[model samples]
Target: MRLRKVMLVFKKDWLEIKRNHEVILPMIIIPLILSIGFPLVFIVGITMVPESASSMEDLENMIRNLPEHERNALSQMTPLQASIYLFTLYFLAPLFLIIPVMVSSVIAADSFAGEKERKTIEALLATPISDSELLLGKVMVSFVPSFMITVISFIAYSILVNILSFTMLGRFLFPNLLWIMLIFCLSPAMAFASICLTVIISAKVKGFREAQQISGMLLLPIIALMLGQIAGIIMLGPVIIGVLTLSIILIDYAVLSLSVRAFKREEILQKLI
Candidate 1:
C-alpha cells in the first residue's frame, strides 16, 4: 500500500471525526470516566472508610487464597491497605481491557456505517484508493486512537492508583510487569481485534446504531473475564496475558482478512443505492 494514500485517508477520517460529535464525544468521554472518574471514586472511598476488624479478617482470608508471593505481599499490609491494594491493583486489571474495546468499536462502528448515514459512501468508493489501502486506513482510524487512549488511560490510572495508595503503602505499587504487559501487549491486541470486528459489521450494517450495537457484543468476553477475576476464578499473570495477546492477534488477522474481502467498493455502492 502507498503510504501517501493511507495517510491521506487517515487525515480525512481524522478531520471527519473531529466534526462529528456523535463519533468523537463518546471516544473521549468514556475513557475519561473509566480511567479517571472510577479510580478517583474508589481511591477516595477507600481512604475515607475506617478499617474494621471484621472487614480485615474477610480480606485476609481472601488474600490467603492467592498465590504464595501475592499473599505474602498483601499479608504485610494492614487490612485496609490490603483491601485497597486488592481493588486497585488486581481487581481493576481485567476491567481495564474494556477501555480499548469500547473506544475502537465506537470509532469503527462509525466508519462505513456513518458514511452511509451521510450519503457519502459512493463518493468514497469512487476514489482511486486500492482496497487494501482503504481497509488499512479505516482500520488505523480506530486502531491508532484506541491504542493511544488505552496507553494514556493506563498511565492516568497508574498515577492515580499509586498516588492514592502511597499514603498507606509508602511506595509506588503500579506499572508492575503484569500491568506493563497488559498495556503494551494485550491491550493493543484487544483494540485491533475490536477494530477488525467493527469494520466488518460496519460494512454490512445500514446504520451507525446497528453497527455499534453489534460491535458492542465484543465486550462480553471482557465482562466475563472481569467477573471471573472477581470470583477468584481467573488471574492475570504473565502466562495468561501472553495467551490472551496471542489469541487476540490471531483473531485480528483472521477478522481483518475477511473484512477486507467483504469491504468491496461495489457492495458498498450497491448498499448506497
Candidate 2:
C-alpha cells in the first residue's frame, strides 16, 4: 500500500525494539562474537602453534578436500598462511549466515507475538493501516536491521581478518568474490525468508519466547552448510553462493506471498479475544 503508512508502522516498531533488551542484546552480542571474537581466537591460536605441528593433519585434510580451484589457490601459500586462509574464509563463512537469520528471527518473533504478550495487539490492529501495509512495515523493520547488522559485521570481520593475517600472508585477505556474493546477495535473501517465516510464526504463537524458540530452528540449514564444508561434502564458491542466493530469493517470494495471504488482522484480533 502506501509507503508513508508502512514507514509509520516501521518507526513505531523500531522505537519499541530499541527499548527491548531481549531483542537488542542478541542483535549486538551475536555479531560481535561471530565477527571479532571467533576470528581473533582462531587466528591467534594458529599463530601460536609451531609450523611443524603434525596436529595440522585435520586441517591439511580439509584443505586437500577442497574444490580444485580452491586447492590451487591455497597451493601457493605456506602451510601457516594456508591454514589461516582456510579457517577465516571457508570455515567461518557459514557462521556469518547465522547472523542475519538469527537477528531477523528475533525481531520478527517479536513482531506480533510480543504485541500479544504485552496486550498491545488490539491497539496495533485498531490503527487505520491495511493488512498489506502492516505486513510490509513489519517485514521491512526486521529485514533492514538484520541486513545492516550483517553488513557491518562483515566489514568488521574483513578488517580484523586482513589485519591479523597480514604478518603471515603479506596481503589483505578479505573481501574476496565469494565473501562479497555471500554477504550482499545471499544474506538479504536469507534474512527476508527468516523474517517472513518468523512473522507468520509470531502471528500464530501465544508469546514472544515461544515464537523465538520456534524460529531458532531456522539455524539448522546454516549449520548443515558449515558441517558440509567441514566434511567436504560441499564448498561455498562464488557459483554456489549465487545459486543459493537465487534459491533463497525464490523461497522468500513464495513465503512472502503466503504470509500476505495468511496475515489477517481480523483473525489475529479474534484470537486476542
On TM-score, the leading prediction is 2
TM-score of 1: 0.93
Question: TM-score of every model?
Answer: 0.93, 0.94
Compared with the true structure, all predictions reach lDDT values of 0.83, 0.88
lDDT of candidate 1 over 1-273, digit per residue (tens): 798898888889999888888878888998999888987787677667654322656654446446789888876877677878888877788767899889888889988898899888888888899978888888898888888888998888888888877877888988698899998999888888888889878888898999999999999998898877766677777788999999989998888888877777778767656
Best by lDDT: 2
Residue 156, candidate 2: how far off, in angstroms? 0.7
lDDT of 1 at 79: 68
Point out the worst 10-residue segment of candidate 2 by lDDT: 50-59
Over 1-273, each residue of candidate 2 has an lDDT whose tens digit, in order, gives 899999999999999999999899999999999889988887777688745322446666577667798778777876777777888888899988999999888899999999999998898899899998999999999999999999999999998888867877778878798899999999888889989999988998888899999999999999999998888778888889999999999999999999999999888877767
Which pairs clash inside model 2?
Answer: none
